[model samples]
Target chain A: MDLGALFGNFNNFLDFTVGGLVIGAIYALVALGYTMVYGVLQLINFAHSEVFMYGTFAVAWTFVLLHGTGDASWSLGRAVPILLVALVAAMLMSAAIALLVERFAYRPLINKNAPKLIALISAIGASFALAEAMGLRDRFAKWFGLDDNLANYVAPNKARDVYSNPVSIQPHGLFHIGGYSVTDVDLVVVVAALVMMFALDIFVRRTKFGRGIRAVAQDPEAAALMGVNSTRVVQVTFLVGGLMAGAAATLYMMKIGSTRQNAGFLLGVKAFTAAVMGGIGNLRGALLGGLLLGVMENWGSAVFGSEWKDVVAFVLLVLILLVRPSGLLGEALGKARA
Target chain B: MLLEVDGLCVNYGHIEAIRDISFGVEEGTVTSLIGANGAGKSTTLKTISGLRKVRAGTITFDGKDITHARPFERVLMGISQSPEGRGCFPGMTVLENLDMGAFVRKDRKSAAYRSDLDRVFDLFPRLKERERQAAGSMSGGEQQMLAIGRALMAKPRLLLLDEPSMGLAPKLIQQIFTIVTEINQQGTTVLLVEQNAAQALKRSDNAHILETGEIVRSGTGHELAGDDSVKAAYLGGDL
Candidate 1:
């Protein structure tokens, strides 16, 4: 009945597919962090998106400090060095933030054996606290002593301005391969995500510390009996997981070229969905799930328009759960089947 | 003494599980706690292994006070426990479970525990056959063997076992008891909790009888097993 509609703009399908793959890679990266922490702790780390958001804000703020907060202070030529600094700063910020969440919020609840609801409340509280601490633009600026400086940076008028440039945010400049054009930023995001994912896989599989992690994930009580320092193991898990979220945040900022105050919220939701799609405790599953979800959302958007992208993930998530509650790979929270 | 528990008490919220329980395990000896259900036998082992807190008492292992230690810290202090109900990681492979037994050994790469792993495999040859199989997927007796082997991997100075004979066939129970003796002879001190009174008493060097959160009798295993009241109440008849 709709043969013309089906055949129309077939090339658009290819473009959306490639674009979806890139987004999927980012989701996979973020999802792996979620999966890893969930694998060991059995807590959702509800503030994890805050961890990612902090990474983004830290990188952006650090760049401002390094390049001076306003127009004509820096050039795109300095991208390489600024990129490194942002990554390192984001990582440090995320690790510190995650550790603080663990120390102030989760650890106490765990000690008290507080019901699951309490932990969830604590997570939500922590998320709100962290988000508001930075989102109340004037208050954050005052506390951090960057009020006037940031205001000027984001002012409506400036030459070669990053903050005040435009209301619409879109990636530009593309390198063509055959008939397809791939932007440098998109390539960087995709490649960086894949590279980090691969490295993380190797670290988990090849290192002695990785074995210790798996051991704890399998049975923390038993692992403790073997002289494995359970506390240290948990801290390290948070650190590594935080680091991944940090890297993903940086890539997101680079690809999107702008980050809203609550940017990590939607990204986090999608990534968490990806994690569940793949199986919450399975590492490779996170990666596969992220890609599948990204592709599904892209195709959905092509058919139904951009507003439906988020809905696509939700639909897939519900369908997957109904079909296989344990997820695509069948892992439960924190207990690896090994 | 390899290990000692003096006046150990434990409470499960409002209910008192154990009160003023005392026992000692000599080095290279099998010390057993035998009792009926709800008699605090497992509770006593849990107190020693640091899984349950001691409300008012002391646990000393090789001259170190461990009453206030954390559970994992107790493992580092050379106390390993194979908990009641076979607390094996069901999702993990048999070999992975064994590797976890050696979790506290930082230098496992160069120790006899490495070879001891092989010995465990030899003792439970069925496990070796299913080394790569998921433990939760295994039979009940096999999971029990995996639990014991995993505990042994800690190379524990004092091993606390809570009901090793639970949920097993009589033949498997005998095999587990024999393994307990073999482990004791291999130089690890053992504190065993069991409901298999006759078999436990026959194999243990020393035994304690618990009834309703209190220790009512203590002696060499033979002495307790030979007691007329013990025979009547626990052994099913005069022996």
Candidate 2:
């Protein structure tokens, strides 16, 4: 470990911190999907990672459709419209996939009164099936005789990393904090994520339908007695979570500039960790957990090595589970502030 | 009859909780099932509220068969339940909990809704005092009041209350029966399940005594209250 180097280089630490916050914002968005599904169903939607993965692909695909696979830079004015469209595309795609997963993978079991463990296994299976389906898009497209026409979307090297057509909104330096530049990309990601999180928190706390979600999460039978349609509530929860993940995907593509079929796997896991760290079912807890996890992971990489960044996240997760299983905020969605 | 249960049989995995129990709740009258804990009073209420599947029975509400209706459908059809154990969402305020009771009402923002809220407050001023307090943090008596008040928010034509006097002091039990009577007089048909025979029987217009899983006796509340056998078995041989 290079503690001496980490302490000696204050500028490097600030840069790492900003970078961590940027990625952390994305994690918070994805984690809401995980936490919300858990809140109502009490099942860890293992396939949720694939939902984010699909959304990232949607973002990439939307960019390709709007602005061919060119590396040419565009002015901010021209890029803004394309970015907005891509955001909507990503949201619709992810929300559709999330609803599909609920319908095909989980609903049947729920209808049959299947055990929760069985549902979890089904989620893991669905996750694999979704990832593999994306990975095998080339072969699937060839079977349908559309490979030649859709080569840009699914062709040579379909399984490998796919880059979005570059919309080079260069990271203009907004300010300097301790000799480290705070770029516009960091500001945009953090602010956009915060806006989405606050909107969701308000919806869950204040709105009537939002109250229905909380009511079902707390007591399904009681909610039914009070005339809350729990099935509709479940669908809405999945939809809301998917929308947040889609927004996160857009921000991620804006910053990272690329995506792959399986990119959601690692990031999804990281977001789940963030959810657990914050308190799995608490909305605001996700925000706090994601930001904290990002900063800590980045700091750990600096002290140790960059390769050990993932290790830092898992280690923190284990520690949190052992010490505070309920998480930093320690409240389920049902018990959160009214 | 506002509600009728004919030949109702409910089972929990082959163990009959309620066996061929048939009763009718008259409109605007309080009907009570007074029995021991394991005599299936709760199961019968649960079946009527659509929480439990009937093995063999027909439950007709306002002359419409509701044997297979979902719980929420029953609520929309003007049936509501203040379930056993006062199932209040602990994370929400008393007001939110009450709001949940009116979940199916489309006129929540109207003056009708406001008057309903006022009625609940008038019925249990204690709930109004702790309107913003979390339902879970309240005393048991207060939660029970909230439960009944919440059921009222549905403006139900027929109300099902399971064990409303289950866990309370003697004084509170008397107070609850009084409110139950009051709510019945206000044009709501009440179906009550209780272990407190004296209080329940005194307030009920019609009463059934359940034993094991069947109704053993049915009479006017005054007749059952005056019966020697009922007094020996349920009322400690005296009122």
Candidate 3:
């Protein structure tokens, strides 16, 4: 790790900065979902990352099928349509998964007046069950006709470099400007994340459903008095959050070019850290906290090398809590409790 | 009758709060339910507002049965309540609270909505000065005004008020009761629950005295105000 070599290498810095932006974007997407749900319910849906995980596999299968149709000619033009279809499919899948989880797992716990800690444990259990169900390679591959040996061969747990070719569909080479070399994938992730964030922010702050969500978040009983169905609003919150997580999953697969079974677990944790780091219930806080964390974590890794990447999240979380626990953009503990 | 509650019973887990209380509020009249603390006055109002669990009987408002309707549904069907403890959405502004109140109404962005808001402001001028202030940041009286204004925004056919004068100064109590009479005079039927039996009876057209979860006495406001036992028990012992 020559100091001069690493500094002179614009590619690594690009991977750090640009990669951080894209990854931070996904984290922000996932974190927004977490923040919105937490804002409304004050309950963490730990299964959200598993929802992301399943979505990655769902999109991957779509891409593989598209690739098998002799459209192995992957280009920026082709990636766009494939990405759109895959995202919609993945969104529907994740939304259904979220609805079921809420209907059976969370709703029952809420009805039982179960402690918050128990709800968290149930969420973790659900996450594990979903992961296992998804990792059964042949079960999913049978649909793609990679049956028998080929089906078992394309295992999800394998390393990203398992392919001999290790395909690198670079988006027409990285463009350089000043100290940054912004890749096509980086632009895609960053733009998608921002678009999604803006859409959600508008939806929560502007739309009728958004007002209902805010009212429900503020006071469920009062929200109900206004003829706002608090329960339905809550369900829609989960549904929207799940949809974002699914889209994040698809963009993540495109950015990384590969994924693993446990991909979303660490990302989910970090994204959740982003949500908490920003203020659990505030929307803009989640996005700011995520991007800030992404940039800082990369900068920290640049200073201390790779081993310190994981430490960055914890250190920043503690420092933020010590200085401003409500997050950078969050106010006092007003609606955090509600 | 505008609002009829028959055999209404409410329980908290195991303990019963109200038992078979029956009442009818005629259209366009101010009806008040006054009782001592823990006598189930608020519970009756909560049941009518669809906020509490009703273990028995039916509630009909404007000839439509709405016993199992959701709280929001009740609001949409022209039934709204200013809840106890001044349950305003604390994080929101006065205007936002009013917006939430008008959640079921279509064309909320129309000029008519703004006019209704102006009416609330005219009724409670204190609210106009603090339109942007958070509801929780206001004083008790201001919060109460916002609560009533919020209920008015719903354009409810029946307005249920739970202890509107609780924790208010005597001067503020008089002001609120005066406004309550005015609100009723404007064609909004009010069913108010109050611990200030004398003031409530003085303000309402019809009155009911609740004791131990049952209506112990019912009459015109002046009759209850003149009754000796009612005065001895509730009006500060013959004040």
Candidate 4:
């Protein structure tokens, strides 16, 4: 709509492009959770959003515990250890929550031979319960009589936005593409995400557990005939998805600096959108969909006011569904073994 | 006996697939269950391999009661099946599919693994040719061979094969039966379910004729093939 402004400000467009890619990397990581779970279970785990949310809190709390609520940035030497600690914390917490959901919420219904729609309803319920439990942490802490000791983690903003300790490492200049200076933060985000993605791809393609997942995905009965325990495969699927969401959460907190109890809701929806856009059960498709969505959303925001960013993203999703419902890759996890 | 099914009954949501079926598969023998469609031949094999629930009676394999065992447990207990319709993992390469067959074995790096792999390749050289190709993209005959070869990779004491010749050409079917006979000769007991009555009867040392989920007749391969009634009903009035 505003082509003149977009063309006139080419430098701003470049900045937006870089920024989009950085955020897109996070979306891709989170989208892996959706795609992998769908690959094995053929169910959209609405509760996966909360898995990411818990990870974001883990990252924030790890920072709060390591460095007090101060605006002091850590030097590169000091930050590396703390960042690694936070990453592990976030991944572990998220994976635990994901496994819990699988065990308590989904497994019961699955064992009962319940319909997919019923499992979906259960996921929605689990999602709400998880978000609400985080939102009501202050009162829950009081019930445990540890509210005063854990005030930093539970207080002041139980139901509101919680800010992470501003221990952000200042970004140095990295390289420039097309006259746009890319920062170290951008490189880290993109590189870390890509490494995780490739690691997951290799694990799925080469490992024995990965083979079990693909077997179950292709044919559960046949997989059983091959001696693959479908239950174990399902657990591994959830755990892997959760780990990726946690990784995304850490990157998101690094870039955005704050989170809410309900933070994962919108982002989870967007990641699911990315998964669908890429190909619901395909690994590479999630990465492609996330990056494409981010760049297009940014461009649309610039052209038609920032308010229309979500509109542009959703409209793109609708258009993609209309044109190719199977997604850009048009292959499920079973067929995308390569 | 390598595998025994005594008074086994299986149901598919109230429709009995197999009823009161009792049979014993002697070790190192090719035992065949010949029948028309819906006669429960496949169902009987599926129940024995632990894929289907038995509503009544017990399945004892190598003298261990496996009636309530899980499918994976059955495999671990040295019983493997190439299920009906040749249930190959379509997304995986032929080598990967074969590897999956040996999933229960922790000795993948041992010489036994190599020998099993070599044996499968020796049995069906076509699978070795398509080692890196996806199983789903292969022809039906090739898929059948891969399915049987995959089952063999498990190194089972007994192999349960369901309709290995279902969709193959006549020549391919003959080749598959020859391999089946060869596999039996190489010290693996076989329980084969087939609609190819003539071919099954020719190869089976002991054969049973199933009708409406029950065993209507049991005899040696020569006895049933020589019987005039069986020749008219199942052998199309000749051979």
TM-score of chain B of each: 0.96, 0.98, 0.96, 0.97
Off by over 4 Å in 2: A75-77, A160-169
For each candidate, the DockQ is 0.60, 0.83, 0.59, 0.75
Clash pairs of candidate 4? none
Off by over 4 Å in 4: A74-77, A166-169, B110-112
Whole-model lDDT, candidate 4? 0.89
Cα lDDT tens digits, model 1, A263-286, are: 778898899999999999788889
Model 3: per-residue Cα lDDT over A1-338, one tens digit each: 33543466776666677657767888899998788888888888999888787677667767765554232435556578877888887888778888877887798887677998999899899988877666565566667766554542355434232221122245654677556667677778889889988998888877778878988788777787778887798789889988998889878777766666677788889999999888888888889878877876776687678778889767988999899877776732235322
Best by DockQ: 2
- Residue B151 error, candidate 1, Å: 1.6
The regions of model 1 sitting more than 4 angstroms off are A1-7, A70-78, A140-178, A333-338
Report lDDT (CA) for all predictions: 0.80, 0.89, 0.80, 0.89
Each prediction's TM-score against the native? 0.91, 0.96, 0.91, 0.95
Ranking by TM-score: 2, 4, 1, 3
Model 1 TM:
0.91
lDDT digits (tens) for residues B1-239 of candidate 1:
88888988899998999988887889888888989999988778777777677789898988999898988788888889888878777767888778878877777787587688898987799999999998888998899999999898888888888888889998888898889988888888888888888988998899989999998999999999999999999999754
The residue-level lDDT of candidate 4 at B226 comes to 92
Ranking by DockQ: 2, 4, 1, 3
Model 1's CAPRI class is medium
- For every model in order, the TM-score on chain A comes to 0.87, 0.96, 0.86, 0.96
For model 2, residues A1-338, the per-residue Cα lDDT tens digits are: 99855677888878888889988999999999999999998989988888888888887787778888777676445677888998899899899989998999999998788999999999999999998888888888888988887888884555565645556666778899998898777888999999999999899988999999999889888999999888899999889988998999988888877777788899999999999999998888889889989888998899899899999988998998899989999858868655
Candidate with better lDDT, 2 vs 4? 4
